[model samples]
Target chain A: MTQALVNGLTLGAVYALVALGYSMVYGILGMINFAHGEIYMLGAFHGILALAFAQHYLANFSPVVCLLGALVLAMLFCGGYGFTLERIAYRPLRHAPVLSPLISAIGMSFLLQNYVMVAQGSGIRGFPMEFGRRLTETRFSAFAGAEFSLLEVFILATSLLCMAGLHLYIYRSKMGKAMRATSQDRRMASLLGVDVDRVISATFIAGSALAAVAGVMVSMYVHAVKFNDGYIMGMKAFTAAVLGGIGNIPGAMLGGVLLGVVENIGIWFLGAGYKDAYSFIVLLLVLIVLPRGILGEQVSDKV
Target chain B: MNITWRGFSGFVFVAALAFAAACGPKGGAGAIRLGVAGPMTGDQAAFGEEVLYGASLAAEEWNERGGVLGKRIKIVKRDDQAKPDQATQAAYELVSEGVAGVIGHFNSGCTIPASEVYHQNNVPMLTPSATNPDITDRKYANIFRVCGRDDDQGRTAAEYAVKTLKVKKVAVLHDRTPYGAGLTDQFKRNIEKSLGAKAIVYYDGFDDKEKFFDPYLQEIKKKDPDLLYFGGIYHQAGPLTVKARELGLRAAVMFGDGVINEQYIESAKEAAEGAYVTFGPDPEKIPAAKGFLEKYRKTYQKPAGAYSIYAYEAANILLASIARAKGTDGKAVSEEIRRSPHESSIGTIRFDGKGDIQGSYYVMWQVRNGKFAALQ
Candidate 1:
């Protein structure tokens, strides 16, 4: 039971990082940003590419330097990609009906997925497992003889740090205040001298960067990378975000961890086959019982 | 108004005529195309990608060896995304592309729908892994399988569990999909037949996406079965083994070919260390498969999966059939496949009257140190 909890929490942390991106964007933009998942995938691909380059050129460097360089590269590339997506796909449709932009987001998601698929052939590529070998050296007793790897610890810590940064940005930073203002009322924010487009783009870039970090962490853990990783992980993160409260920042963190724990416990109790259903069922139940989520403030549309 | 209506009718008639003309056979001197359809995306893409590699390699080898029936063999590939509807569409697309035969629709659910299109279009389809008995039970003349049916694999697994493992009490779990359910049914029946009342507990029809299994696990724990058999893919099997271990169940866990993948080890972690699974012998271990592996690794820069050799053998068989038939005609090629005794990576290959392989060659392996090792 304890091992399951630890495993759940580790996975939940990654999900939470990815979910925060979704929650943050939704909080400010009132849009689902379906392409968020594709950014995560590109992040993984960038990590693999960076590792390859490190192996080829920086062979003399320590493994830690190589991994850190890869992670940074992954974050930058994915962040840039996210910014590009917002500028090219979302920006034009920002003033259009909400449905049009939503559809465009979905289209962009497919386009990015197909782009990766074509570039990376339709095969499961193996990443060098040794990329972060040193980091996984630490082991902690979790439950009933189960040991937690250092990779898991790194994932959890990084996720928490990202979450903290997000919280600070949203609550304390000037641009973050403008984001909240724009989310609360776009026209009013524009009238008050806020650049709504820049805020929205910034929201996407920040979320994309977080997602990229999560993707790199996941690739390190899984040791295999594929184009479709985003689809499943994205769905789970979205579920986590919704579970915590679709637009609630802290709620997403809690929801991600809770969903992970629920899934692990479900697998432990029910058998592994029903893990996905268990998560969805929890989401459905939460949505039905507390539509605004555990920490979200319920909002009523002003007619 | 009358002139506009007359013009519209004339346009419709001309379009119908053009459609008919396009559908008509365009026979020319060119290479015969064989379509290979499978999930080239989504979760099961690994399986499909490997199969395509095997098929493509076979086509290349056949073309190099003086071509098939004085013409080059070409394989047109399609991504089915593992969905039945998409499989059907892919099948039509392949048929329209003028392929003489198809090598797959890898999943039974997808194959079932895609097979109908192949049947309607008179294209022979030889499935590599789809093992549902109903696939061939429909007796579609164009449909056949290179891999053993679920009944064979399930019965073989059960025999190993009851006789070899000396499992006294066993519990069965299935993913509730057609393939999973069918395999579980066969396994349960065979185990009961061999061990009599020893096959005590049977739990079938579990959802693939559900995360929690505590209620079911608690109930299963009470039964205290000596062995557990899971009829599902790696996604579920990996976690199932891990959770079972966590639940303090020391029972030996076994599964069918669906759970055979490196992903299972990663997902299940140490829990997969002792789990056994029955599948077509890993190509890496086969002496005949060595040459193919070297060539595959050189070309694709990766080792082939367990079933890739079988897929390669299947393609070899199809090409040989076309060569023997001396034409790309579906009925003639299928007749050749039925009659010809071919040799390839998986040993002597011959399909029985029902389009099933003649030999019962299933290998059992145990996961050890995050890799599958052949059980002695």
Candidate 2:
């Protein structure tokens, strides 16, 4: 049971990191960023690729340095991808019928998935297991027999830090306030001298960078990355967003952690085959009982 | 325009007939045509490529050796897309092409339904990788498989787990595909029959599409099974094994033949060390296959994967059977295939009453030093 809790928390941390993207994009644009998962997938690919190149070029560099390089490359590449995605697929459809952008989001999701599938053959690839090896060298036991490796601790800590950083940025920073204003009323914010387009693009960049961190952490934890990893991960984070109130940031984090814990507890009783179903079941129950989610005060249905 | 049900049914019937006509194979008197069908595209395409490469190599060699029955053999390829319906269509297309015999439909789900089509047309169908026991249990005389059955390999795995590894508690998990679920069922049954139900600590399943197994691992860790048996393709087994080890579980991991590829070892990295798998006699080990392996490497620039040798032998068996029967007719070739023993790289291939290869056996393999070495 303790082990399940630890596993759930680790998993929930990654899900929350991903959920931030979905929740942030929805907070600002009132549209689901369906392509967020693909950005995460690319992040894993880029991180591993960067690690491989770094190891090859700088053989004597410490593992920490190589990993930091991987993290930076992944974040930069995913941020650029997120920015370009908005420019190409979402920007033009922003002013059309709301349905048009939603459809475009779904289409963009498939387009990115297939593009990656074609680029990387439908095989699982991995970063060197050296990351895991290094991670295992330092570990602490959380409780009776359930040990917490450095990787899990790092994932949780980094995720919390990112969430905290985003929280402070959104509440205290001028640009973040402008983003909040733009999200509130795009026309009014623009009239009040806010660059709405830039705010939306910045939102995508920040959200995608957080997702990239989650992706890199997951790849290292699991020891492999696949082209199709985006779909299920994306859906779970989306569920986390919806469960926490789609446009609420802290709610997204709370929902993600709760969903992961609930899923693990549910899997213990239901078995592993129904692992994916547990999230949906929780989503349904939440939708039926708490329509506005745990932290959500009311259903605005609009940004 | 309002359409009546009767009119719709007639339209459907006509359309079906026309579609059948379009897919029917054309008769070729110049070349003795042979067909290969498998998932040329999709997730399982690598397996299909194995069948294609090995079978094509066999045909190339036979043609170089003055062709079968004085006629140069031509190989026709079809993509089953790993689907039963597509396999059935490929079967019908192969029959229509007047191919003497076929060597395909890699997955058990595809092989089972598609073999019926080959049976109806009296064309011999020899699968290279499909291993479900019911595949040959259907008693189709035209159906044969070069690979060993799930039951055979599963029994081997169970015996290894009990008698060799000497593990007290065992947990079996499958991916819920026809191959995975079927193999797991057989493995569980054999384990229970040998060691009793209490010896088997836990049994469960997971969808093949699942990305993470930490939840399952955490729960299984509580049970403290010493041996974890995975019944699935390498894609899932590789990561599952890695994740299990990551959680500090010291359980010995074992799997079926689906993970024979070196890619499994690569993906699992150090975690793959000490893992066990059951497969047909290592083709690379047999002295008879040394030349074939060398030729294959020379041509393809890669080591022959698991099913490549099986496919080569399937092709050899089919062509030899056709030659022995002295015809390009499907019924005659199929009869010869069923009736006589033929020599090939694997060995003297002879079928049992159920059309499974006679004396088919599986050997254990272990990942040691990043390579799958045969475990004696």
Candidate 3:
């Protein structure tokens, strides 16, 4: 039971970070950024490439430095990717029918997925051992039967830290206020000199960076990365986003944690085959009463 | 509304494209074209490339000896993308091209349905890796595979678990793929037969693309089974093994032939140590295979894949049968292949009535120091 919860939290933490990005985009553009998962996938690949470079080409770097370096590199790369995606893919189609942008998002997702597959051969790329093997091998017990590996600890701590940082950025900062305003009313925010374009760009960058954190952690935990790893994860996080109320920040987090716990517990009762089915059931049951999601109506999460 | 030169040119171009499609590359100018089909361009491209390269090597060898039936043997390749619909399309295209026979299809799901298209068209289809029993169970005289069936591999694993490993309270998992589900069902049936129904504490199947196994491991951790069997490919198995060990799953982890790829050990890393898998005896130990292995390395400038040798033997047997039959007739060539006993790199090949190889054996292998070694 203790192990299940910890595992759920570790998995949920990554989902929350991914949901945060997903929610931010939906809140601002009023469009689901289907390509967000692809951004996450790209981040994972970049993280591994950076980690490999640090561990092999560079000399005498500590594992922490290498990891942090990978995280930063992944964030920057994906942050730019998100910004450029908005400009090239989303921005041009902004004035078109809402469905047009949604379709564009889907197209962008495939484009990025294929781009990664082409750039890096479609083989399952492994992480540097200093990071992947050494980390997972080192484990510490939480209680009598509960053990948390370094990879899990890293993923949980990093997700919480990123979430906290994102929360603060959205609430305590001026740019965050601009974002909230834009999500509520794009034209009005633009009329008020908020630089809605800049605010939207910032939103995508922030969401993408958080997704990068999740991506890097997942690749590290699994010890490998693949081109299409993001598709399912993106969908799962989107479910989390919808459950918490599509655009709600805190809702996305809560939904993520809840979905993860439910999935793990579902396995406990139903067996492994029902793992995915449980997620849908949770969404349906929750939507029956709170359709917008648990935190769907909250103002803070809209940003 | 007006008929212009531009419209006329576009119409003419479209007509030309259709005409070209209607008659594309007929039998490579009098050569006996053997179609090579698999996912040559997608996620499973590696396996398809192995089929191509391996069959190409066999074709090159046969050409050197004097082409099949005094005609140069030409290899025609098609990309199935490991999809059922695309596989059938590849099969249709291959049939339309008037090929002698096909040696391909890396996945059992693709092979199963694609075989029907070949069967209906009367083109012999022999897969190198597709291991589902139904592929042979259909007893489509036109369909066959070089690899051992899932039931054979599953029974071997179950027997080893019950007797050699001395394990009880088994947990079986599959990825719900035709291959995975079929193999897991066989393992479950056998394990239950040996240890009784109550011994199978947990039996379930998950999606092939699923990444999380923590929940399943959590439940299995509680069940505390002595043996855990996964009937799936390495991508899911690797992470599942890593998580199982992480959650302190002490059961002896076992896998079917799907884990033969190095990616299994690569992804699982140190956690893969001590885990067991069932597969054919290592090619490294086959004395007859020594020359082919060496030649494969020398010719390709790379190590042979898990299915490469099987593909080579499959192609060799097919070509040799075509030689003996002295024709590209599907029924005659397939009949000859099933009837004759040919010694190849893997071993002596002899097909039963259902077009299955005789004496196909599965051996237990353990991962030690990040590599699989056949248990003595």
Candidate 2 residues A116-220, lDDT tens each?
A: 878987678876766457785477877777767888888899899999999998999998999888777889999999999999999999999999999898999
Q: Fill in the DockQ of model 2.
A: 0.48
Ranking by DockQ: 3, 2, 1
Alpha-carbon RMSD of each model: 6.1, 5.9, 3.8
Clashes of each: 20, 2, 1
The reply for model 3, stretches above 4 Å from the true place, is A132-147, A298-303, B1-29, B41-43, B64-66, B70-72, B81-86, B223-226
What TM-score, to 2 decimal places, does chain A of model 2 have? 0.96
| DockQ head-to-head 2 vs 3, winner | 3
**Which runs of model 1 end up more than 4 angstroms from their true locations?**
A1-9, A47-73, A119-121, A125-154, A220-223, A265-274, A285-303, B1-31, B42-46, B53-74, B96-98, B120-122, B157-309, B312-336, B339-348, B364-376
What are the Cα lDDT values of the candidates?
0.81, 0.85, 0.85
Task: TM-score for candidate 2, please give it.
Answer: 0.88
Q: Over the stretch B1-376, how does candidate 2's per-residue lDDT look in tens digits?
A: 3578889999999999888776653334567888999988665667788889999999999989989888888899999977778989998898888787889889887888888888888888899899999989988878898889999989999999989998888888888878888998999999999889997777888887776687777667778998999888887788888889877788999999878877788788888999999988877778999999999999999888788988998999999888888886777777888888777777888898888988858989999999998976
Ten residues in sequence with the least summed lDDT for candidate 2 chain B: B21-30
Error of 2 at A106 (Å): 4.2
- Candidate 3 reaches a DockQ of 0.53
Higher-scoring candidate on TM-score, 1 or 3: 3
Clashing pairs in 2: B25-B96, B25-B97
Per residue, candidate 1 scores C-alpha lDDT tens digits across B1-376 of 9999999999999999888777643332277887899988776777888899989999999878867777777779999988788999999999999898898988888898999998888788899889988999888777889887898888889888877899988888887877888998999989889888556575746765433343455446667889888888776676567557655577899998887777778656666888999887667767987999999889898877766777787888888787788787888888888887788776787877778878876778899888998784
